[model samples]
Target: EPEVTQTPSHQVTQMGQEVILRCVPISNHLYFYWYRQILGQKVEFLVSFYNNEISEKSEIFDDQFSVERPDGSNFTLKIRSTKLEDSAMYFCASSRDRVDSGNTIYFGEGSWLTVV
Candidate 1:
């Protein structure tokens, strides 16, 4: 079976630093997304990417945050200036179907980001 894989399993940086989280989804699937999980809180959707543009995005995905599907295989999220509140576990996900459809979304182990 195929699964999503993320690089730099754990990342720590000072406040105001830049961070980039990378992911590779299942080879044959489409509809990619990024979700954030703050400690002890419900998972929150950050941004959704499809057909090379943003399909949906939450408030948390502000100017400080950006996403890209470079080379059509790897998806990346870049945080321009880290903040203390930015500390969380970021998950990379994908599905064969659209968000409203009854399709299974696969999640990566997560790229943990901590800001000090």
Candidate 2:
């Protein structure tokens, strides 16, 4: 089965530096989303994109963050300036079903970000 994949399962960066996390979502799926979990916290939604534009976004998706579908299979999330508080497990998910059903969303193992 096709599955979502993320690179560099863990990332370490200095505060204020820019970082880009990469993902390869499941092929043939239409909806994509980014979510983060700060160590012990509940997973929080960052953004969702479809049809090449953002469909939904949470407050955490501030100016410092942006996402792109650089190619047919790759999706990327860029953080303009990393902060210590930004450290977390970033997950990439995709679903063929609509958001209302919430069944198709499949999450990657996660890319752990650490800022110091």
Whole-model Cα lDDT of every candidate shown, in order: 0.94, 0.93
Per-candidate TM equals 0.96, 0.96
Q: What is the C-alpha RMSD of each candidate to the true structure, in Å?
A: 1.0, 1.1
lDDT of 1: 0.94
The TM-score that candidate 1 achieves is: 0.96
Q: Model 1, stretches more than 4 Å misplaced?
A: none
In candidate 2, list every pair of residues with a backbone clash.
Answer: none
- For candidate 2, write residues 1-116 as lDDT tens digits: 78999987999999999999999999988999999999999999999999998999999999999999989999999998899999999999998866666566889889999999
lDDT of 1 by residue, 1-116 (tens): 89999987999999999999999998887899999999999999999988889999999999999999889789999999899999999999999888665888999999999999
Error of 1 at 68 (Å): 0.5
The per-residue C-alpha lDDT of model 2 at residue 2 equals 81
